[model samples]
Target: MPAPRIKSPALLVAESGADREGHGLRRTLGRFQLVCFGIGAIVGTGIFVGLSDSVAQAGPAVVVSFVLAAVTCVFTAFAFAELGGAIPVSGSSYSFAYAGLGETTAFLVGWCLLLEYGVSVSAVAVGWSQYVDELLHSLTGLNLPHALAAGPGDGGVVNLPAVIVIALASVLLVRGVRESARATAAMAVLKIAVLVAFCAIGFVAFQDGNLSPFSPAGLGGIGAGTTAAFFSYIGFDAITTAGEEARDPRRDIPFAILVCIGVVTLLYCAVALAAIGALGGDGVGDRPAALSHVVNEVTGSAVGGGVIAFGAVVAIASVVLAVMYGQTRILMSMSRDGLVPRVFEKVSPRTATPVAGTLIVGVVFAVPAAFASLDSVVNLCTIGTLATMVTVNIAVIALRRREPDLARTFRVPLYPATPLLGIGFCLYLIYETGPATWFQFAVFLAAGLLLYAGYGRRNSRLGRGGDQGLTPGDAGRVRQEA
Candidate 1:
């Protein structure tokens, strides 16, 4: 016989030599550090730049859209909470799906996450560049040449600052998670501070007239804005990726995910309301209708706009740090599972961090950051990530059926109903974003599927009795069929 494939219903990829051989490391993460990671990742992307985009799409009713986004995330967060408690692994739901669904399904989940994380880094970096460029002009009255500051479509050869930020973030990831979380926390604070300032300054000039055309595009605008604003919920899932490192993942993961989503939604609503109040509801939607310029009209000086701009810069810095951090961990998890090159699985002995894995991820983000558009990249990020959330909702159902006996630290509050709602909401968001974004998402997912067919299927350690090294109870871990 050529071979009798040892099919594992669970999607867990058995460890290969690359996994066990490379890590003789230690654990350094605690609840506080992990919380910082959640906060860092959650705070950046929307506040810095997407704020204008959401405001434009939803009009002043973007606040209502934010509530919708938060509500949707809460439903999924419940599903994630259940999984984090049951399967405290890195890869988030990708790992959970492997153990609950099957290898093929797990591969898809992992692929979706990679799509989310990879494109997210690019989106964050591009946003960071915008802020950095503005901060530079404000601080020194001399900014980078427009050619260097922008992407090709914007008349630039390369986005120098975006690449630089991505490069720096990669270096930080290679160091260790704790060190990274500290930096992220600091940046998160500055970003939030800037936003609070926006609220204060923008509110002073608030006019009742701005709320007149609350839904300029009608209720459809609110729906589209809610869909567009789903981008803000992307980073909350970063909470679960740290399951292994968290001091009490069951409690911490659920808490962080929910808290981050809630907090971020509040921040986004504040910024949206303030911008609409000062800019007449439809103002500050696009680059030409920029948030800073609108603030200038009300505050009468660049100081207010400068503060928000500065905040955007600081916020994006943390985003690059946090998203890059999430990206490295996802690769490390896959590496340990034999889905990718072994070097990516290697963790540093001194720092107990995935140094090699982070370096490779760094290179991936830097290239795109050097060339891509902030708007396109961010939307592309949403399609893939929202797809992953869809999978998590599915995985929640699969696991309930497959492993009812498994310990769950936190259960989805409404069982099947909650997860189903999550799935529906995610799909709706993807639909409103348009067909083009989905096209890119499809292309990226197709690439991942090809990689899995060509490499993952053959190299999977479970196909080789490689996971027998796991603890006795964990021996049948990946094969617990539904």
Candidate 2:
């Protein structure tokens, strides 16, 4: 009657068990696969292509920026881990908000996730195309025509390689979660190995003078570099999106998240140090394939560069696969609650995946990857992710207060302080995005709210009195399923 503001944690838990007969997503992912998934998603375009820009912003002090960004993510990751264990659902932060915040707030969080995961898939795919062209030229001394190699805004007819990579990732997702996990695991290993090799080669040429006057632009430059580096950490939280599909989500999701943050942080710092030490900030320049360029410069061999380019290709592809998987699952959760079309909720019994939803995401995002410039949209993605993370941090506090005795496998060490810091850090990063990014994010939120008012509010399952029979006690009984 009052606009279905909230859904009790118990009801959400009970509803998760509705697929006991196996019509929903299958729980084939374990701790190892989830770790790989997080790694696969986190170590892509940001390191391969975006590092040069961060170096330019802060000189050699980009290493410190990497640490600062990781610290911000660590705070939010703790909040995510705590809630992820308590409410293991595919909707992730959206579902957490629905239970602790309200239906409208949940819809908005889901809308933000659309920007974080859906647009991210296209953005990563576009980055992948550059590496593909690099690798092709290295191997065959030939390259894709400009018209087929870049988005129209980049002076091309269409980005054919970007579309192809998205299509490939979508097909893997439609086949089944287990198959996708295996492919991701393989690529994850390859990419990590490649990064390790690059670090090794770069360190051989390390010179102390290259790292001198590290904070060339002082605090201001470091802060800007941190903002640039923060985008590299975008996919670590994606581990929680596998809640329904994790074999023991309550345990595995949190573990995978923490491990992912640690692994990615160490790798990023190592790569940043090695690149800056070997060539200095000026040498890194502003190249699209920064990592490969560094390796070539250090060794004076195109072969080394070619290998790094191949790794970037694999790394970006894995991000596309893992992030696209997260996007479809979130949409499926939204559809289940009648906030979107029912087609998204349909699962293929044979594959045990959301076939329709995955395909739709692939097609919708690929168009932007093919035809539009993503320079501005990348900032939009960063803002959307930060906003949702702020919601997640608050949702952690709300759920703790609302469900005081709810069984939780993991708990934030400092309770209110941790989530509070997470919120502050997220908001600060959001502020650093500048006025133009804020305007774009405001428009995105306005469109989302308009859609919710027009359709989602009326059709929500809770608004239809569908939760009448569910009670708080039901949560304890269905804890394992959740």
| TM-score against native, each model | 0.91, 0.97
- In terms of lDDT, the best-performing candidate is 2
Q: What digit string (tens of lDDT, one per residue) describes model 1 on residues 1-482?
A: 34423222222333421112233433355666666677788777666677677777878888899899888888888888777756656778677677666666777777777667877888777777887776666677777888887788567888889888888888887777677777877887777777788788788988889887788888888988887787876787877777666655556677677667777778888878887888775567765325667677886877666776777777777877888777777777777767777887777888778887787888877888788787767777777778878888888897788667666667787677899999998888888878888787788878888998899877877665676565544435432321
The window of 10 residues in a row where model 2 has the poorest summed lDDT is 14-23
- TM-score attained by model 2: 0.97
- State the displacement of the C-alpha of residue 197, model 2, in Å, after optimal TM-score superposition: 0.5
> Per-residue lDDT for 1-482 in model 2, tens only?
66547987667757766324353778899999999999998999889878987898889999999998998999999988988888778888888889888999999999999888989888888889999998988788898998999987889999999999999999999999999999999999999999999999989999999998889999999988888888889888788888888888888889999999999999999999999899989988477788888888888878898999999999999999999988998898899899999999999989998898999999999999998765646788989999999999998888788788776788898878888998888888888888999998999999999999999988988888776676555655655443
Give the per-residue Cα lDDT of candidate 2 at 153: 85
Each candidate structure's count of clashing pairs? 2, 0
Error of 2 at 67 (Å): 0.8
Candidate 2: the clashing residue pairs are none
Error of 1 at 137 (Å): 1.8
